[model samples]
Target: MKNYFYFLFFFLIPFGCDNTKGNKLVEKSTNDSSSIYLDKAQKKNIKQSEKLKYYKKSFSILKNQTNDSITRSKLFELTKELYKNNFSEDFLESANLLTTLSTKAKDSFYLAQIHRSKGNYYKNLPNYDSSFIHYTEAEKILKKIKNNDGLSLVLINRSLIQFDTGDYTGADKALNSAYLISKKNNEIASLYAISVMMGLTSMETKDFDKAIKYFNNGLEIIKNNNNLLGEFNKETCLNNIGLSYQKKEDYKKSIDFFKTALKNKSIKSEDPELYSLLIDNLGYSYLKTGNLDEALKLFLESLKIREELKYYNLIVLSKVHLSEYYRQIKDTSNAKKEITEALFIAKKKKTHRDYIAALKQASIIDVQNASTYSKEYIRLSDSIRNVEILSQEKFARIQLETDEIIKEKDILEDKNRSLLYTFIGVVFLLSMLFVVRAQRARTKELMFKQAQQRANEEIYNLLMAQQDVIDQSREIEKKKIARDLHDGILSRMFGARLNLDSINHLDDPESVKKRLEYLNELKEIEQDIREISHDLSREKQDLINNFVSITTNLFEEQTATHSAKLTYFMDSSIKWDLVKNNIKINVFRILQEGLQNINKYAKANTITVNFRKENNELHISIEDDGIGFDVSKKSKGIGMQNMISRAIDCNGKLDINSSKENGTKITLNIPLE
Candidate 1:
């Protein structure tokens, strides 16, 4: 939820190059001593073995050639093809040559393109720092040249890196910026890609409706294009949309989308990755929809392809899902084996998401065995979630540093301009003093008044700046605590779970029961760990939206506890993403205080939390059917002051309405963008 926007933006990058021709390249035998020629058969036969030789020759020729952007572009394309084929040496060499040629040609566009390609290479290598640098450089160049297409492309690429590196917020911003530019330029390919990304981000953030809308828009664009690859992308979007709906417990709609996505399989035989993904998604969908047989069959088919292709990551994911499926059908033995296998792979891969998933499956297995494995699963899940939280915080810190540098640069420039203007004014004043004494006196008085006003403004700005620094420090501390919880406590608990598992295998029944009880206690600890991890990772800004739900739940629980007739209504469909952590905490505290006030004074039997969004604004209404106070006559209390301050902190507004014999309604409106 913290980086929901970032997720949306990062998803758009692949679509930028969607217009490129399908994966078809010229091939030649490495051993064959034949002259290179551009022909249909030769182009169709391109192989990895010959890539280095061909790229080297092509790059050498292009380096010597002058006054030919078109030729240079073609050579760059060849280099990209080489890189795509995993010819690392050839790719780097060609990329370097292309960079030199583009620079000499003074072609900013091509330079940006070369940088983007280099960024892609580094990105695939998982060198996120280098990838981000290249992307930033390319963005600067594109912006300077006012090339919207180039800028959008760079933004998309940058977003991908951010998403991979856990900078979801940055990724979202980059993606949204690219989407606006693409829409303005009427770039269909970019638009479709952006749409897909938006859907993906929405799905990531658990906004099912938004995810569906984005996928639908992307499908519409792909349908209009009549492109096979676009269709493939559309299928992926549909699969994700279905998965999102499934997460929200909408089985009927999820099944519908999964079936629709499977309707196209023209290239499934040629693209194992695509085929495997589709099958796995379908299997998962079926599992969710209670179609055990269909789920098992699809999952098995997917596992086969994954094994053949040696896609270990996907294999781990599939195995865990299958384990869950088997467990649902009461096949405990098979479930245990599959889950154990998944755990081994997850440990080997050190992939946090996969590790957490495997642990979740293992926990289900523990339910049947009544063994310590459940504790182990919980421990591992907690550890993985903690690490994820730390990674997210690290990314946020890096972005903050980058932002600070830009702000400092702007301040320096402003100071320099002000100094230059002051110097010029002084010279003019001295030179014209005698000629316009009366006018000069008036000007001096005005300057005196302006200087006094400016001084006061500067003092006010300094105080605000100091407050901001303090807030930032607090945020950083919170992130540190979150990281510590994830890395230290969670990891130790997991280790404890492993120890408990060892105890469970002992022969003595007495020891086994003792170990099982210990494991159960650990399981509770693990649950607490997960809850804390999630809470820490959640951005403080999202508390505004979460408050409505939280308050509604509290009201319901209170009613049930007190045996009072209380009616509570909530929208339950409002979508929100946390923009910052500080905002989230403040909003949460404010809501807490409001609820406390209601419990003490409102004396209401019913409550309602209404949430709605209009463009860039968010609206929240909390009302209770209780004895209300007179707003005009009653003095403002500490709770009101706290709520007002919280609203001001987020640049939001709060309105409170109440009267004798009537319930109170507190409406909070916040700007989201």
Candidate 2:
């Protein structure tokens, strides 16, 4: 019943450290003394202080030498190495010196690199806004210079900023752009970085299979270029692959991958953090497989290491796993203890995802308080989803602003060329504009007709609703009449016949007496039949009479309650039976609404409603003599709209004519067919 927090795999985005190599700054000049210092600074088996000394010596030598390509290249290489090694003070000093030299040499390429390196610096400081600004500036320069490799690397850096801000979709878009550029330019290091990033992005979106595929792609790339990824990088890929499989619930495969990652003996000492993660994941897989003993052992080992390192988030994760393990073993007390501690740490860290996880585990183990925990979990989960959506929108806005900045620069550069084509472009646009306007007018007409049709269908449903009620009442009346005829009239006639027969069997005197009584009974039955026949005829007439009665009542109400005088005419030649029920319903509704409108708005002294049959078409006209307003100018009210819709529903057309101080006339014509 309890859910546990899954271990989050850590994937490091490699920002192409290999790209720093093969600097053109001083590579051509082997005779320069600075080259020797540069080579020594790149050696792996060196102390930070020693590397700093060599870089400083190269900078000093190159400063005194002539500012030729060799001198400038050597100085740039020294500055880049300092930046890479985290010699902040020395790196700043050397970069400032190189900035002056490169500007004097008019080197746009090196200048752009400085900006990119600064962006990385700010990104590590977690100042995403500043980092984004620097990346944008570098991108502009690279685009201008048409250096695809530099542009690709800058795009990757921008994507990392986006990723850190919880804008996974934006990050994916940036990564895709970078991937395309890097692949086209055959930039291996950039390609590897993009693949790893894309995989991590996929994992964030819960596409575990896609993530595994991308991770495998990274491994394949590493296989071909051993120098592209170190042993630790390879270990990351394996761990991530394991995590993806775990998410997919393929526990056995996850265990295999996690074990393979843990096989690196030096991981425990070299990267204790990654080692803890691997073991915890392996333990969780064991828990899922019901291997309680091994699961508990690995869980405790991972928890102890995380505690030593004081990683709050990791500690919470381990406790959650332990809670799940305890719950599996039916050890409720221990499960409660572990989950409570995990929940406390998660809340203190304000780690929303982990907090939600802890809450879910709490709900399952602590049955008495499960409802409260579950409510909080749902609330936090919804809040985090909304926040992530907003974060994505914010990052998208930042990218848009950056694009606008570049677009402005391009506009300035293309100003003259654009001017040359403006006249011809304007002529073409004018022609297209006329065509578009005509098409849009036609589209609007079609849309209006469609809307009217929908309204007609809706009115038809309303009419059917009324018809259903009437038909139900008529059916009930018919049933009552049938029962009376069968039970009362037919039964009495049958009894009278039997009586007459029984009399005939007796003496002539008794038979005459019974025959006289039978005649009297027959007379009474004949009266019942006559009354029933008349009732049936009346019921049949009510069908057509229903419409007339309703219209008459409407007109009477207006005359009795209002100041206006109402007059209505119905043509005797019009056969009510020939008209469809739907048409009758629509005409009755329209006449009713039109009279009400006259009473309310058309302060007319006389109102007339005329119904006539002409050439197989039914025409209804309502005229009001009140101070009539302009028909073309007045907006159609809801009542008028309904009237028009009903008219259209019956295959009819409505027309209205009115003028100031003149009577208003509305006419509806519907085909009888």
Candidate 3:
């Protein structure tokens, strides 16, 4: 398990560039002259102004001829590249356009591509579940079209995500699928990336020799190519070989390869961070070879670069190295300080790799704290390994489910073929077919009735629960009123009555003054009773609108249940007499359902529930800071369906506007005379 944990930590280190590659995306077509991943976009060369200029040109051209396949395709391809290259402002526009175009065209190929784009987009957002959904949709479409290229791309994309999530087995299977496509197509560029990933997975299983073979194949594919990716690939190959050698305890060859990777111009210009990491890795190699001075110098240089860049995780790595160097040199104080800082960062950031490294190092230098550090290292190792296992199992489940779906589809196709062959025999069986159809219709009707019954029962339960809450609130209000009247108003009234009687027994000016004071007190008591009565009326009865009261109660409950902060307000000036009970009830139900949905899924930090009257229409809006889906693309779940039903029942319009990063907003409008 401990070995497995280390494998995960080293998982992507050999890949080189990592997410920084996203930043370097240059606009390129499929035939782009680059050897990196196919058509790697060059972001550093394209200024923001240039991107915006081209985007405006493309937008204007595409907007005028949206229905034109040529223009739409060009616009989509351009925007897709632009978005991937980190030109994010146009992403939503691209998504909206592609989705609209795909729907209008009703082309499975275009729709599949759209879903594929969505999966890629969500993967970048670190939304694995959404990515999985999009990928599944794309896979289904690809199967329908039998598009090997599309399937291979989906596998490659999903494999990268799976690897990041610690699903090594799943990642390997996906890479293997892509490997077959590469073999059949002779896709050198695709093969290069797939081989690297396969090699990384092999490393996880401790297959050093197999990992080397894959890395070497990748190297051969791009070693002589003049493209930017080719240059980057060469650097990747060298680094991975070096890391493999180091892992295998072959420090001399590892140090040699590390030095060669550092000299690559791509590493120097495009990724200084990668350069620093190589330096750090080389320092480890030097340390293993007993080159203390070289190791210390390289470690400090790496630390200095990381500090300048403020690369947090890399900074933790550099600090760990520095701590080890200090420990070697018998600088106990500095060793303690460096490792302590590294440990602090690891804990604060929840970086298991750094945490493990720091714990292991501390156990060596700080004997008194060694046992504590060792225990923590063991615990975190177990935890990381357990998560890896879960990820693997979940990925396997996804594969199994996907395979089952495909098998079902194949069976259905076979059954349809049999029906086609038996058509003439079946022609004389029309009467029997009708009878079967009628029986199916009856069964469908019966099922529909049962479903309807269940829905009604659920609605009734909801209403009952709501009523129970209201009743409890009423009971609590009654107790509060009783306490206030008895403890406050009654006591004051009793004191005033006693004073009134005493006042009649005196005739002096002071006695008269006391009588007047008693009368004032009596008047005040009467005012208090009136105030209490009004309070009871407000609490017990909905003054302005029951819709507002109910929504407020539900929002308060949601806020209490979740971590999200809530702000709510209802217009107090609206006349309740003008609003019908049916509309009020429907609106209340809609608001309740909407808020419940938000609480369950929204992972939001803040929410707003607003109620107002505008142009003789009651407008109720619920908004959240949670991750929201595209309302147009997202399926309407039963909760949303129920809300829509209630809105229709009230003769109101329900509008939902939502997106991933911006969140969801639901607006309901009901007419009031």
Name the runs in model 3 displaced over 4 angstroms.
1-75, 85-90, 100-104, 224-228, 263-266, 402-673
Judging by lDDT, tell me the better candidate of 2 and 3: 2
Lowest summed lDDT over 10 consecutive residues: which window, candidate 2? 1-10
Which segments of candidate 1 are over 4 A away from where they belong? Answer: 1-51, 61-78, 100-107, 265-272, 367-673
Q: TM per model? A: 0.50, 0.50, 0.50
| Per-residue lDDT of 198 in model 3 | 83
- TM-score of decoy 1: 0.50
What does candidate 2's lDDT look like per residue over 115-199, in tens digits?
A: 7877777787766666776787777776777766577878888887777667887889889988889888877767777877788
Per-candidate local distance difference test: 0.67, 0.76, 0.71
Ranking by lDDT: 2, 3, 1
Candidate 1, 207-315: lDDT as tens digits = 7788788888877877777453333666666776777777788877877887787787673675667667767777787888788899999999989998998877788
Q: What is candidate 1's CA lDDT for residue 34?
A: 22
lDDT, residue 24, model 3? 22
| CA deviation > 4 Å runs, candidate 2 | 1-75, 89-106, 232-234, 263-266, 347-353, 367-387, 403-673
